[model samples]
Target: MHSLNRLARIAAVLYLLIAVIGPFSIIYVPSTLVVAGDAAATTSNLAASTGLFQAGLVGYLIIFLAEIVLTVILFDLFKAVDHTLSMTAMAARLAMTIIHGLNLLSLFVVSLLASGAAYLSVFDPAQLDALVLLLFNAHDLGYTIGIVFLSLHVMVLGYLVYQSGFLPQVLGILLVLAGLGYVIDSAGLLFFDSYLTTPFYVAIPIAIAEVAFPLWLLIKGVKEEALPKAAPQPA
Candidate 1:
């Protein structure tokens, strides 16, 4: 296989792995653990499933590390379209990646709380429960902050692909809309109480763009004949 094709396929595989691993750990597992109004049950559930909680944390760490690799590969893939914009997009993704890496520490703390660590003996049971829930809340909101930068990365990536003359323009447009959808959802989720009360379906569009983009990269890659060439400047 050609170098570009190989890179695309490798990145695609990583993207797929992340998609599979990320939701189970970051969303589904936590959603199951953190009961809405029942702090006692939440604490009990986490304490009982110490292994599950630790697995989820490890899963998140894997996703964060994989994301850094994917970002670098994508930067190389798209830089030919516009060097400055490509770098900007990569930088935005790197920032978000680092933030999420730190955000996962919140889960790490929860594991310690759930484990009945000796050092935690200073805090009463009720306090520990409250602290765990608080950390969970903080982790969720910190994800929104990371989304702000990830949204920027997606928008610039969309623009770069659209200008590249290799991929379909519609994909680029959809990618941009995906980023916008995330911004709207994040803004509302953070700033407005109503958003929390409702389902965050605004992000559904992201699945569309994200899945399609990677599939295209893996299956179709760039049309070699259609790849853009640098234009000569007037003498």
Candidate 2:
């Protein structure tokens, strides 16, 4: 039981780390710097605040590492509920993390292009700016693609949590709803041109589900007696 609580706390802490870092790096910096649909303005903002852009990249790196760790820990914490389902969820989450890691390369290239390096004399300044905006847009799309896989992880995880009899069943339901929201959002982005123009407030309610999960882990931990006994191994 002690081990379970400790593991849950570690996973929760790692999630909180991403929560803090992700907003600053992914949303705050870009929103503050990049003026949407104005390539020149976006480029100017990035060029002016090069240090801030670099810091965002660093935050993403931490997110990548922390997400990998948290996913593995979650798999262990819930595996007893259903080994196959837990492994599936873990694999999906790992895939999402890997995709996000590759997406970071796009940010790196954009940063380099906008860094005002003398070697970039071959390209026009306006061209560089446009390219940077293009890459940033692509990064956003790639992140949404990753969220599709993450949704699968969340859906599977919800079932495991529901069956485990440890965490609240409502938490599981909320997780499933969150996963559904991701699926809808990702699919809408991929399929509907209008989705690009639409506001993303739908994710706000879904986020409550995510917030509750970590808080429960930190506060309630788990019901130790509700955990299932391990199956005996064949000799």
Candidate 3:
């Protein structure tokens, strides 16, 4: 059981890393590559640019798959905590997990559409219009839903971390910030069109903290000496 618990924790960490870092890095790299290239490039150069874009799309799909695995393993770890939280808190966490899983499926569909469009672009640009429309609309909607649920999930996670004593309060604070950043970014994209890009920067730190803190918790477990004991009160 101890080993199983440790494995679950490790899986959760890997999932978080792949899901957050993989997609972000992939997108940034290809975009940078394209921007740094010559403006007046040949068909081959364009093809290379497209190839970079395709790589990012593939990376997004990989991240989605990792997210699914991470969420499942985290759920298992939550069950292993051996601590009882409020019913509302438990429900919130479960809801967040379910919503995240749904978001992953939505992302997977978007990636498939993107991949199809990329392949079709090699033949004719006109062929990709419908796929592009479908992919963008789905992505926008998915982002909106994901941000809302993720915000709630992070808040719940903060509370859980506070109660667990196994995880640090600072980590919980970071989760809260990350959740708020998502909400702000999603809203900005939907409504403002132009706003501070701070959320994007905020996300990098949040992602790093998320992977680090959870892995630490899983490996070290709670500080046995620091854990508070449950007290019996009036019924």
Best by TM-score: 2
For candidate 3, what is the lDDT? Answer: 0.54
TM-score of 2: 0.93
The CA lDDT of each predicted structure is 0.84, 0.88, 0.54
Clashing pairs in 3: none
**Which window of 10 residues has the lowest lDDT sum in candidate 1?**
226-235
The TM-score that candidate 3 achieves is 0.60
**lDDT tens digits by residue: candidate 1, 124-200:** 99899899888888999898899899999999999988888878998899899888987887788789977774244
Runs in model 3 with CA error above 4 Å?
2-8, 19-21, 24-26, 29-46, 80-141, 199-208, 218-221, 224-235
Residue-pair clashes per candidate, as listed? Answer: 0, 0, 0
Clashing pairs in 1: none
Model 2 Cα RMSD, 1 decimal: 2.2
lDDT of 2 by residue, 1-235 (tens): 4488889899989989999899999889888887878999998888789889899999999999999999999988988888888889999999999999999999999978976789999999788888999999899889989999999999898888888888999989889988888888889998887886324565864788889999999988998878897544334
| Model 1 TM | 0.92
Among all candidates shown, the one with the greatest lDDT: 2
Model 2 regions lying over 4 Å from their true place: 197-201, 231-235
